[model samples]
Target chain A: MPTQANSSEPPELGLSGRKIIYDEDGKPCRSCNTLLDFKFVTGKLTGAEGTKPLSAQAPAECLEKLGTGTVTSAAIGESSSKAYPKEDPPDVNQLGRASWTLLHSVAAKYPNSPSDTQKQEMKQFMTIFSHVYPCGWCAKDFEKFIKHNSPKVDSKEDLGRWICTAHNEVNEKLGKEKFDCDLWKKRWVDGWD
Target chain B: MPTQANSSEPPELGLSGRKIIYDEDGKPCRSCNTLLDFKFVTGKLTGAEGTKPLSAQAPAECLEKLGTGTVTSAAIGESSSKAYPKEDPPDVNQLGRASWTLLHSVAAKYPNSPSDTQKQEMKQFMTIFSHVYPCGWCAKDFEKFIKHNSPKVDSKEDLGRWICTAHNEVNEKLGKEKFDCDLWKKRWVDGWD
Candidate 1:
């Protein structure tokens, strides 16, 4: 069984036979039921209207109306673990580590005296990277960081140190220990002594 | 002692008290000496000119001229493990995994019916991503892939399927098993069965 909340009707009973809880904004509380409930309620409120209640509907019927097309509870149950049968996708920490690696490696390879084209490309890359980064909140934060401390792409050393300092700022926000900016090359490019 | 290779002069000897090995293309072979050899040789070939021979140069002098500044063999030794002192940056495999996760997640979250702006943005993101991807060889390969099989971004399902197929191409190249495209939604967005 699933839960249901209608914006048109007063928030009362859910499809799971539990009372629907509303947030201060009068939207159904997301934590009240499964993610399906949240989607159903929000979907109804937004575009689709007068959808059949989930309690009275079969899974296929509900999925068809929702335009999700034949989702099964078994699939949802397995996916609840957040791992696919064959592989698990990277989480936030993994994404952070990979992104840092790419950034540092790029800095490591940045020429000491970049051509005008190279410098402009780097700038464009950073701007587009900030916009399209998968994590919306993290991307927004990075955009602000970039605005405050614009990329220094004049030289490799300068760019490396600038990026290191910026990364340290993120570390500070996350309560992680800050890295020494002076050791940027040693850590990222050349082997440490 | 660091090795030396001059593009002007024939590849002969190295400061490591050993002969420098050259690839078929006459570039210094990466396997010989250390990563230092590759950097020094390539650095010489590219920008810095006539930077005295490493054989005659002290570690300090070499570092200064190279603009790498005070790298020690011990530092390289530690970084060889691919882990920084405090943090381990993602290696190629880790980066691949994380990147795939981010790509799939983004595709999953893409709107079923996106605005023109969203469609253009996705296309632009892929183009920039191909250019700025940290791994140079991988970026070149992806560019080829993009050229051959352009992104299908009309709808969320189209985008997801397109990305999954692209990922499969990479997996195939890596000699990894291909994923069943039918299960993409289950694996990425809706849990798997």
Candidate 2:
């Protein structure tokens, strides 16, 4: 279900007459596919070209046509920007699941009454984490999330609830189900005994 | 398969003459279960107690005996330490997977030649990460991993390989299969296509 850059073309035409999802080296750009469309297009649900699914790997005529100087840089940029305004990378789902697991688990173990240093370090860690998160656009969104919500690190309960709400915001954006924040203790800390 | 604190104590005796995983407050300590044993013992692979599995949540008599001033604190500490030796919390696996996902993805996206500030921030992030990792003992092992290998952030390839090797080290300890470092890009950056 992996949609390569070579997934044919949409009805709309770009300046080059095709949207560019890959870079000049034929490497797929991390943000070229939104996780939503990435999920849909790469989903085997999309009809295949023949017996096999579409290979994003094919060196499309559009790719070769690019960098030939016939296509203006501004045209290509405008075209691509129109298509994937908020794309996630190919492995965005993998990255996302892993990040949530870690964030929630860390919040679960936070001290009931954290020291000032612990609280400060946690906030600082979020700042550093946002900077280093693999996906450029996703990181930008996380930065916004942190800026608006900030990290509530005063207590373990505070942090847990805050992170759950943060995760819900992401889920809502992705159109995924929002988890019950009340179940934070059951999911992260105590087993459902 | 979720083991609760009510599970009957192992045959091993502590100062109270019974292994105690839960604290006096009836809350499971974050470091009480190693991810290894957590996977195994809580695994459905283990036969159930009576069509039902053991629960770790039951307030065992040992907890009641602790604060009554009869049992010495030293004895209690010695017993618990001797049993776990090196343990990860209940959600260690969840945390571990998330940490690795973020780590590999970040490495995959690393610039071929990072600026000095970028390199320093990545290294500093690891140090802070090792400290804030949810699992107590797992963090210690990660500290050891960092001490020995250090973060190789010179280039994208350097960091990708380094992170892959680091992941292999953890896999070795956890009895998980080793990943091919050669496939770092294929797994983290690009799709199988």
Candidate 3:
């Protein structure tokens, strides 16, 4: 059964590679196996919150079909060592589908994501966000926020502010008095973004 | 086999669903089936590009496996009307994929697409452009230009002149020494800001 960590707490975010199903000797990649690297260049993970899979994480069946040889894990570094402490309090927002969208918005707004891996993560977040919130109006609002803040952005704080503004506006237009920024923040993290 | 229209001349950009597709009783849908009202709105054409089949037009064999219905078609519009009458052709630099990137740069800069369709199309164009071109540096330059010009932009003519300046700077940096503004003017319809 899949593990279910607290779906509410911010969890530690990291990238993982497939575990090589090796022969008895544990040699390198077998002839029929290919090792794929699933790197989470940046993510928010709190033990209280479960690690939501990025949309890029194919179904287990698909991964099995790819026939990965082995799996390895690595911890993603917090973007700025001085900016965030080693063990910041768990962020409730980084726990669900909403948080995933938030993460993507955050990553996209990051000013200096120079590596291909960062770009890939951002793309994955966008794809997953599309599936959960399939509204054009929402997308328009998000895009507007990103376009304005992307050049000047580089962290989750920037995205949080954008989301705060966008979500409020969207909810207001929908005439829904109950807008859940924190709920969405958790969903964004718990889901994928 | 895919139908080939004029290879040298720009064909008319019209949706196929604009024509009537008669039912067994010979009744036409009051609404046109063109790509928009049919597959696009339903999300069937999400990742489609040139030659990508719309759901309504998918092959019977393909649809049958998925348990679908049949569709009939007749070319309604005159083929001669495909090309636009000479109304100042768009600039050359504004043709094809490159021009599309420029359009998105404008949209991304202004970030208020006319419609959801425009947003979706712009996103698709950006995806394709990113894959085909080393556009990061160029995008930065475009962004810079937009930042400066957006404040003064008031009319289409202003936009055109701004595009002319940005395109020249970009082409110059990319070593496109022979780049002609007249050519870009002709293809400007492709999308420039």
Candidate 4:
């Protein structure tokens, strides 16, 4: 059983009152929620209102709410029970999904017969995206992925297929289902038929 | 009254069967939904289920579901009254929001005192982002914005502030509230207290 923290008082407004999981350098860990869950089976979770323990399963509706990124900022605090009505910052998974959507959408719109300049720019974009992506470990993984499989910018279709394959690689690593590359056009460019 | 297309048979599975607003070159117009709505004011809409006309209002629950990117792809097709159970591709607004979230989150995590290489990479990232953002008009506007106010990537804080201001500019154009720049750390780096 996880240690239960007393939750009687209304929590303070900011991170000052929260029990943040920190790294060796005292910086708050980006994956604090996962880390905290792994270390202890705490019944009460922080940063999300009505978050259940890791062992306890939440109903589909609750999970849907959480997945939709509707949880308030106050609920995300360290052990706070109050649900302030402010949008919470997205976590790594949310960020990743969003980033992938943007990237794939952009690729879908790439000019079919792109100029040399366009191709060069797309390559640069991927390189920079790998560098600036917020998740440190994920960025490193992308960088390595790029090194092994350079971007194919010959045409719009090429770029779209390349991105889809790259996305599938990430999905495979995460144990998620791989999207059919053949449906790339249908999914992004042409819409499903 | 808007011209009503006969809703006799179930539409084809692809975008071709849908009445997508297209440019002269047969490319799907970026503002198809808006264009379609302007041309027709019928309660029944296509391409994005539950998407209201610009003048109409959606209830909070519908808006929340839209914000959460929950509408299925089937909801986006022509005359599809049945709501499919699977996750759908994100619409333009949802895609934009998600993209912004990733960009802002990455900017928030930038190194405060970035090295020259980091600075160069960040600058490059902005340039490429402006060029390749999926929305055509949005990309053009971003390009202009970049030309007017070059990206400031000297430090992490500088980048965060710059991005926040840029985001606010977009918000201003969209008639949305501007986020407080002072709360950058609280919103992105640290959990709110």
Which candidate number would show the highest TM-score if scored against the true structure? 4
Estimate, for each residue in A1-193, the C-alpha lDDT of model 1 and write its tens digit: 4333434675465443334555455765432233344445555423332344554434533433333222212222243334345432333344566567767766776778888877877777677667666555667888998998888989899888888987898789755667768768666765432
* Candidate 1 lDDT score at position B52: 40
- Which window of ten consecutive residues has the lowest lDDT sum in model 3 chain A? A87-96
Candidate 4, B1-193: lDDT as tens digits: 1133335432222111223344457544433223232123223335544333222244433433443333333443432443223333455466677788887888777887899999998888898888888767778888899999999999878888888888889878765667777766666666454
Candidates 1 and 4 compared by lDDT, better number? 4
Please, what is the TM-score per model? 0.56, 0.63, 0.22, 0.72
Task: Rank candidates, DockQ, best first.
Answer: 4, 2, 1, 3
Q: Which is the better candidate, 1 or 4, if ranked by TM-score? A: 4
- Residue ranges of candidate 1 with Cα displaced over 4 Å: A1-86, B1-90
Q: Higher DockQ: candidate 2 or 3?
A: 2
Task: Write model 4 residue lDDT over A1-193, tens digit each, in one string.
Answer: 2333444442222121123344456544453233232122223345433333323244533433443344423442332343233545666556777888888888877898999988999999998888888767678889999999999999988998999989999889755567777767766665443
Residue B152's lDDT within candidate 3 is 27
User: What's the lDDT for residue B140 in model 2?
Assistant: 82
What does candidate 3's lDDT look like per residue over A82-191, in tens digits?
22112211111111223333233343324333445544544444443432222233445556655564422334544454555555654465343433444433322222
Which run of 10 residues does model 2 chain A get worst, by summed lDDT? Answer: A69-78
Per-prediction share of native contacts kept: 0.16, 0.44, 0.00, 0.55
* Backbone collision tally, model 3: 53
> lDDT score, residue A28, model 4?
42
